[model samples]
Structure formats: C-alpha cells, structure tokens
Target chain A: MDVSFLFGQFLGGLTTAMFLFLIASGLSLVFGVMRVLNFAHGSFYMIGAYLAWQAMQWLEPTLHRFWLAALVAALGVALLGAVIERVLLRHLYGREELYQLLFTYALVLILGDAAKAIWGTQQLSVSRPPLLAGGLDILGTTLPTYNLFIMLIGPAIAVAAWLLLTRSNAGRLVRAAALDREMLGALGANVGAIYTGMFVVSSFLAGLAGALVTPIQSIVPGMDVEIIVEAFIVVVIGGLGSFWGTFWGSVIYGQVLSFGILVFPSFSIFSVFALMAVILIVRPWGLFGRPIR
Target chain B: MSRCRILAAACLAACLAPFAAGAESTIKIGFPMPLSGPAAVYGAPVTKGAEMAVQEINAHGGVLGHKLELLERDSKASADEAVRLARELIIKDNVDFLVGTLTSAEAPAVSTIAKENRIVFIAPTSKSVQLTSPKNLHPYLFRLASNTDIEGHSAASIIAGWKEVKRVAIIAPDYAYGRDAVAAFIGYLKKARPDIQIVDQQWPKLGQSDFTPFITAQMGTHPDAIFCDVYGGDFVTFAKQAGPLGYFKAVNNRLVDGGEVGTTDEAQALGADYPYGIWSDAYDPVIWAGDEPPEHKAFIEHLKAFTHEKYGSGWAIMGYSAIVALTDAIKKANSTDSDKVSKSLLGLTFDTPVGKRTFNAKTHETEMGEFWGQMVKGEHYPFAIISNPKYLAVGPFTD
Candidate 1:
C-alpha cells in the first residue's frame, strides 16, 4: 500500500510488458503479412534460448561472449524460418485458413518433441552477465539491472520497428501485401519473397526476445506451450496486424497482472481472460485491427 | 526326409515354441512410470535403475529358478493412463507383479487395480500421504520410497534447529502433494518451535513460469524462513525468478525445501544461479559417499556408469530399492504366487542400495526417510554439494 511498494510492482509489470511486446510484435507482424497463424512461434523462442546457451557454452562462456552468442542464435532461428517459409509455408498459402492452422499446430507438436529429444527434460539456466548481475537502488526499492536492460530493449525495438515499417520501401510492399496480395502480384511484385522476408524478420524478433530472457529464465522443455499461450493472448488483445496495438496491449496486460496478484492473488489469471472477453465483445477484430473480409 | 514331413515338423516346432518358453518359467514385473513427459526427468532414471537391478538379479541365476522380465509402460504421469496401463499389464501381459509409478496421482489408480486383481503393487517414488494412508491403503499395496510426512518432518527438524529462524513462510504447488507437504511441515514446525509465527503462504499453480507475483507477495510478509515444496521444472523457474529479487539473500530469512532442489543435477544445471547456503533434502551421491556400506558404494558406481554420468539422483535409488524389496519378498516367500508374496512383503526387511529397509506390517510403507543437508560448493563435489548430511528416520506418521 506504500508508494515505494507500488513503484516496485509497476516496474515488475513493466519487465513483463517488455518481454510480452518483444514476443507479440513478431507474431502480429507474421499474421499481418502472411495470413498464416503460426502456433509454433513459441517453439522458435524456446530453440533460441537453448541454442544461445549451447553457443555460449561452446564459446568461452565468459560474460563478454553471451550477447554475441544470443544474437547468432536468434539469427539461426531466422534462417530456419526462411527455410520453412520456402519449403512448407509457401505451398500452403493457397489453401484454406483452417488447414494452415492445423499445419502450424502440427508443427508445434513436432518441434516440441524435437526440442525435448535434443535438450532432454532437465532445466538449463544461463548465468546473468557479470556487469548486470546485481541490483541498483531506484528510490527506496532495489531493481535488478538485467530487468532494466530488458525494459529499455522493448521500446528501442519498438522505435526501430516503427522506422522500418514507415521509412523503408520493403515496408510499403509489406503494407500493400497485407491489404491485397493479388494486386501486388499483378503489379509485378515478388509476393513470395516478401512473405519469406516477413516470416524471417518476425521469427528473428521472437528469437531475440527468447534470447534476451534466457539469463533470467530457466530454459526447459514445455516452456514453448506456456509462452505461446500468453503470446496469443497479447496478440489477440492487440490488433493482429497493428504494431503500436501490441505495444499498448502488452503494457496494459503487464500492469493488470502485476496489480491483480496484489489485489486478488487467486484470480489474477482470470483477469487476463476477463479483459480479453470484454475486448472480444466490444471489438471482435481488436482495437486497431481491420474487419475481416 | 520327405518335403511334406519336413514342412509339417517345422509347423509343429513353431507351435510348441511358445509352450516350451512358458514352461521355462519367468517372473514378470509390470513397470509403469512417466517415461515421456515432464516427469520423465525423474522417472527415466528410475526406469534405468529398475532395469539394472533386474539385470543384476537375473544374471545371478534369477529369483527362485525364474528369470526376471520387466514389462515397462509409459504412464505419462496421468491417473487415467496409469489405470489403463495397469489393466493392460495385468490382463494382456499376465504379469506376476506391478511396480514403478512416479507421481502420487498415478499411485492410487495403480494400487486400486492391483488390489482388485490380487496383484502385488510396489510404488518406487510416489510420496503423497494419501497413497499410504489408511483411507486408501490396500493389502497388496506397498511403498518403498519415503512419503511426504517423512520429508516434511526432516525439513522441519532442520529448520527448527536454525538459531536465527523465528518467522516462516510457505510456498508449494497448488495440488495434493503441495498442500500435504506444507501441512506436514507446518505441523512438525509448530510442534518444534511453538513460538514460530507463519507470516505468509503461496500456492502457485503447478508449472507456473512467472514467479514475480508470488515473490513480491512473499517478500511483503518478510518471514525469516520460507519452506518450499516446488520441484522439477517449476523449481528451476522459481529459483531464477526469485534469486534476482533477493529472495535468497534477505538477512536471517533462509529457504528450506523438500526433495530434489539442491541435488548435483540441479546445481550443475543452475550453475551460478543456485542459491547457496539454503537448506534442502536430496538423494545425492555426495551424501551417499564417505562412510557407507560397500554395496552402497558399489551401487552408486554402477548407476553412474550405467547412466553414463547422466543421472544419479535419489529416484534411481528408489527404483533400485523397489526391485530389491520385491525380489526379497519373493525370496522370502520362496514362491511366485501374488498372495504369498504380498503376505511376505509385510514386515519384510531387505538390503537396498541406500541401506537396510523394512516395510511396516500395518501401513505397508517402508522405513525410508530422507537425507537432509545444507547446499554448498566444496572441493569434494564438482557440482552443488550437500556439506553436512544426516539421515532422519521415518516416524509412525509417515505412512
């Protein structure tokens, strides 16, 4: 009930918001351009964390090597996404949405099992970077330095994403593809290449988010299911294709969860569903999403 | 040797092969445990231990002129699956005995089927109090592993002895095992320290990934010690999330936990994130080393080699012990009849990898307790080590 406690809770919520935004933005981007509902997005995130840890271990495992390994691991997932887009998703684009959904869901099961086979069920933890290992005093409460880094990364990526969408020529093509892919194809645009690029970029974002949180989270099998469920909620709450929508949605959700735990400890999980239900009732397509054709 | 006669003779030989194999006589055990789920980390090692024990026993010329055969099935850590497999193992395989269930949820279902069919059931690692309690107790059901009551008391005894501890908090999974573990710990804790005040309690749903809310809530109450019963993947998540919030380092507020938290596997996995100086109970190799029987040392070595240095947790020991006890009961009865073996299992004493264990006649629960110690990184262990180890006896209430 004190000011400092409230401030601390708000910061904790911000940390959650940052990670949610980092993950949900990628999912929203994919849905916007490709019209494919990727249920296996969480698998990419999980693999990013595992591969990052593996990469760091293979390297010196020093604090200096961690950030570089994380970047490379995320790139690895991006490369994988590109291959998947070329080999599998390209063929499925002409099919019904339900079939696409089923395919992605199948991928979820296959990827989850593959991860278990590779990593085993034992939980793996990544050590905090030595520089950000401890806490810093903010007012009367202490906050972890690593948490602050994650919070900053969220908005920094948001700005970078905004610029990429608004300023870049590829961004214009992406917006056009979201509106009408047939017209863009008729206009002599390589629609296939654009879709692949979008998928790769989105997967990279997801992988980056996963790698960023690895230092604080214990990477384990089945984590993909846990995260993907939450990511779906975030994307749904935000408009599916809206960038700023995801940012706001994550922030709102994070605050609600943080405060809900304090006010209603048992019902905190229900709070998220309640908010989503209300949004669905009022704006079925989400706050910023366009009506489905 | 006409072609027609040779073909007929081949057919006859093939038909009689099954009968001859049946005549040879083999003791079969239906081993159902979580082999392909989140619980497999614990269950797989147990399966390995049971396999090794059976192999060793069979190599020494079997149990009473019958080769030991294990019919292993994946229970998937579900009660429904366990019950289904129990029926299949019995009706389909026609096994002589049932053993090896991982979780408490699977324990009762398997035991019920075992009782109804008059088959002997031995649970290697299910530790919920309800499994062995009189309410669910059946004549054919026996447990070789220590239950929650013993573990809780062992944890409480250690916590009570901590000189600076005055207030306590509790956190566990929101299920049967978690609730019972906390209750048992609190009951013994209150008895030990009558003046101790319980400040807070948190029961996060099992498999909860985010512990920030729970951590913040627990920190608000400001207890001197927190007793946690969360294990497996959830434990790792809690440790990672809570460590940053200074949950482990808050002055005079130590953390006490039951089962598998500070073991070598966890310590190696967590690396620098492992909470040093926290008190926990583990079935650890370091605890087994130094001064123990030669057989215990040999069992440890064998398990390490067999697992290829992958698993050597207490679950392995439990699995190894279950087979030892079952074989011992059969040896004592000197027969393969389920009813006779079940009767012999009552008040049966047997040598295990850990030590000599006896099943109490009334409860059908073993005298297995827990090994309690403080987590430390020392020269003796490459990973997390239990520096000071002590074994507590399973009291009357454990069953």
Candidate 2:
C-alpha cells in the first residue's frame, strides 16, 4: 500500500519476469525458426543447473567462481543442444510436426532420467558469488544484489538477442529461414547450419537461465517439468514466436503472480492462468503471433 | 508334440511353485512408496529401512516361524498410482499386510483400499490427520507418524515460550496439510497466548520455486516471528532466497518451521546455508549429544551399512519401525489373517530404533514424538545439527 512496499513488490515482479524471460525467449525463438515446440527446453535448463553445480564442485572457491561455473554450464548445454539437433532433431524436421513434438517429449523423458542417473535424486543448491551475495536498500526496502544482477542481465540478453536477429547476417538468414526455408536454401544460405545455430543459441539462453536460477531455487529432480509448464504459459500468452511478445508476456505474468498473492491470496495460483485465458480470448493468435495460414 | 507338451508343463510348474511355497513359508507385506521424483529423497531411505528390518528379522529366524517378504512397489507419489498398486499387491501378489506411502495425498487413498480389502495397513510417513480422522478411520488402517494437530500444537508450544514474540506471520503450502497444520497452530497459539496477533498468512503452492514476493509481502507486515511449513528442497530454496533479503534478521531469527527441516537430509542439503538459530523438529537425529542408547547406536551402525552411506538418515527409522511393528503384530496374532493382525495392532507396543511406540487402540494412531531444537553449525559434520534438542512427546498434546 505504501511507496516502499509497492516498490519492493515491483522489484520482486521484475526479478520473476527476468527469470521467465530468460527461459521463455529461447523456447519462443526455437519455435519461431525451427517450427518445433521443443519440450526438452526445460530439460536443457535443468541440465545447465546440474552442470554448474558440478563445475562449482571442481573449481576453487573464489569471488568469480559462480560466474565461471554458470558460463561453463551454459556452454555445456549449448553443445548438448547442437548434438541433439544434429543427431536426432534434424531427421525429424521434414516429418510431421507431431513427430517433432514426440521426439522432443522423448528427449525430455530421457534427459530427466539421465539427469537422475548422473546427479542422483538429492536436491542441490549453489551459493551466489561473493560480489552479489548481499543486499542493497532502495526505497526503504531490501533487494538482493543477485536479483538486481538478474534484472540487469535479462534486458542485456534481450538487447543482444534482438541485435543478433535484426542487425547481424546470421540473424537475417535465420529470419529468412523462419519465413521461408526453401527461399533461404535457394539463396545459398546453408539452411541446416542456420537451424542448428539457432537451436544452439536458444539452448544457451535456457542454460544460462537455469544456471542463474541455482542461487535462488533448489535444483531438484522434476524441476525440468515444473519449469516447462511456466515457460510454455509465457510463450503462449506472449504470442508463440514473437520475441517482444514473450518479453511483455513474462512481464505481465511476473507482476500478476507477485501482486496476485497480495490482492487475492486464495486465488493466486489461478491468477496466471486466468490472465492467459483472457488474453487468448482477446488475441487468439497471441499478442504478436501471426494468424495461421 | 511330446517335447513341446513337456516344456509347457515345466513352465506351469515354475510359475505355480512360488505361490505354493510362499503361502506356507512367508507373510507378504505390500509396501508402496515414492521411489523416484522429489519425494524419493525420503522414500528411498525409507525403503532401505524396511529392507533392513526384513533382513534382520529373517536372519533372526523370521517372525512367527515365517519369513517376512516385502513386496515393494514404486507409487511415484501419485494417489491414483498408490491405490492401484495397493489393490494389485493385495489381489495379485496376495500380500497379507499393507505398508508404505510417503505423501499425505497417497496415504489416504491407499488407506481406503486397505479398508475395502480388510487388510491391516500402517502408514509410516504420511502425517495428514485426515488419514485417520473419525470419518476416514477404519479398523484396518493405522498411522505411525504424528498427525498435523500434534505437530501444530507442538510448534505453538515452542513459539509460546518466546516472550518477545507477539505478532506472527504464517507461510505454508496451500493444501490440506499446510492449511490444517497452520489452523491447528493458530488454534493452539490463541489458547496459549491471547495477546499474540496474527499479522499475515501466505499460502504458496507446494514446490513453489520463488518465495521472494511472499517473503517481501510478509516482511511488510513487520511480524516479530514467522511459522513456516515449507519442507525439503522447497525449504532449501526458501532459506537461500530469504537470507540475502535480511528476512531472517528482520524477524530476529524467530522462524519456527514445523515441516521437519531439522532432519539431517535437509540440514546436509543446505550445508552452511541453513539458518542456524531457527527452531525446527525432526523424527530422529543421527548425532546424540547425551549418552547414546546402545540400541540406537547399533541401529545407526546397521543403517550406515545397509544404506552404504557414511551417515544414517533420520527418515529411515519411520519405515524400519513400521515393518518391525507389523511383524510384531503378526507374532502377537499368531496368524496372517487381517482380522487377527488388525486387532492385535490396536494398543500394540513395539520397539523401534528411537524408543518404544504404541498405537492407540481407539484412534488407530501412534503416539510418536519428535525432537525439537535449534539448528547450529556442527563440530564434526559439515552440515548443521540440532542443538540441545528436547523431545516433545505426542501424548500430552494428543490426549
């Protein structure tokens, strides 16, 4: 009700939005260009968190240890995405969309079980880097320095991703392939390479989100499935393939979830879905998605 | 044709042999538990405990001159799956007794099946009071864990002693277990400390990843203390997120968590991140500061060997006690009949690794107590351990 309390709530919403955007952007991009709803995106995110936890174990404790571990995890998951794209996803691209969906779903299950096998079922946690381990007082309310880092990084990643898609050659090629793969192929741009490259970038975003979330959330089994549901909600409400749509959707969702509990304590769980339903009723193709052909 | 007929006859004999031999030599106890997923953190250890009990009993010439055979099945923490498995174990496997189920959701459903089939069922871990509420209570079903009311009352007693605390905030998962426990806590707290004001209550969904909003909002109320029911990985997430925000410092470290966060599994998982001064409860503690009983010491040693881990889990005692109790009931009844076993289990006292526990004849509930203490950095172990724990017996509150 007061300025400080409202501001604190706003910051919390923004922090939630950042995490949602990080995971949803990759999912949206993959669907935009690849036309494949990668069900395994959350699995990639979970793997990233586990990999970072593993990296931290191997590395010496230092101020930059968390950052280094996150980078390692992101790269590791990106490489895994590339391999999966090449070995399995590539073969199913020309088939029915159902096949691709099933393939990705299968990947989710396999990766989930594989993570269990490797990490065991114990929940794992990661400490924030010493530089960002404390808090800062703003508007008479305390906000975690780590959360502030996420809020800043979320926008930076968004700008970087936008620039890659609009200003760079690879970006143009990917956009072209998303519009018409045959035309891009005829123009002598290796369509397969562009697809694989897009998948890797999308995977990197997911992995990064996963690694960053380790300091905030418990890295546990079934985290993959838990996150995928929220990520899917973000993407669907934002407009399936639109980058800015995903961004705004996450922003809306994060705020609603943060404030919903305060306003309607008993119905907070349904608030997100209720907003999604209203959006779908108003904008059937999402806020920014194109109408089906 | 003759050779084919001979092979078919041999296969039939092989299939029927176990059933024929099992009926006379073994008492089958069907155990359905969450062996995978998030709940597996507790479930896997619980199963190991049951296995250890069966092994020890069998080694000691079995119970009632019959080997106790455990038919363990993974319920995956699903209520429907647990019910289906319970039925399958009863009808298909012909298990004479039913035991196991981790979550509050799964236990009640399986209890219904036990009632329908007239088989004695003992729940080891599920603490929902609904499982044995007068409406749901049956002759066949028995609960080994302390129910929500007892847990809540115990928590309130702990909080009431804090003279400085007046305004309190509650945060728990928004479900039956959380709702019931918090309600019970409030009911008791009001009776104990009428001056205490309930400032705020936040019902986050179970397994909620983010607690920042709830934490901030609750802090806005400026309560002197908080009663938290979040447990396991969720608690780990909550503590890590809440720490940097000065949430603990804001409340002056007066968070009394009733979700058994004092257990070694959670303490070890959180490591140094665990809030040291907060009060919590656990069913068992591996490290006993006072003179450790030989029975407990031997149990811990056997558990370490059985689990193949350096440290024994406090959770393992639940399953171990259940099996031991079931076998003891069988020995008392002198038969595997459900009627005899169920009747024998009423008011039955059994020895556990912790201490002797008895099932209440009227309620079909065990008077199980828990160790309440403050979490502090351990001297020997890297994780936190309970400091100067006081055992809160369920008898006073349950009665």
DockQ of each: 0.46, 0.71
Top candidate on lDDT is: 2
Off by over 4 Å in 2: B1-24, B394-399
Best by TM-score: 2
Stretches of model 1 off by over 4 angstroms after superposition: A266-268, A277-293, B1-24, B285-290, B393-399
What local distance difference test score does each model get?
Answer: 0.82, 0.89
Residue B220, model 1: Cα distance from true site in angstroms: 2.1
Worst 10 residues of 2 chain B by lDDT: B390-399
What is the CA-based DockQ of model 2?
0.71
lDDT of 2: 0.89
Clashing pairs in 2: none
Candidate 2 lDDT by residue in tens digits, B1-399: 999999999999999998798668688899999987888888988898999999999999998788889999989899999999999999999899999999999999999999999999999999888889899999999999988888888888888889999899999988888988888899888888999999999988887867888888888889999999999889999999899888999988899998989988888888888888898998888777556678989999999998888888889999999999998998899889999999999999999877889999999988577888888888898888888777885322331
For model 2, the docking class works out as medium
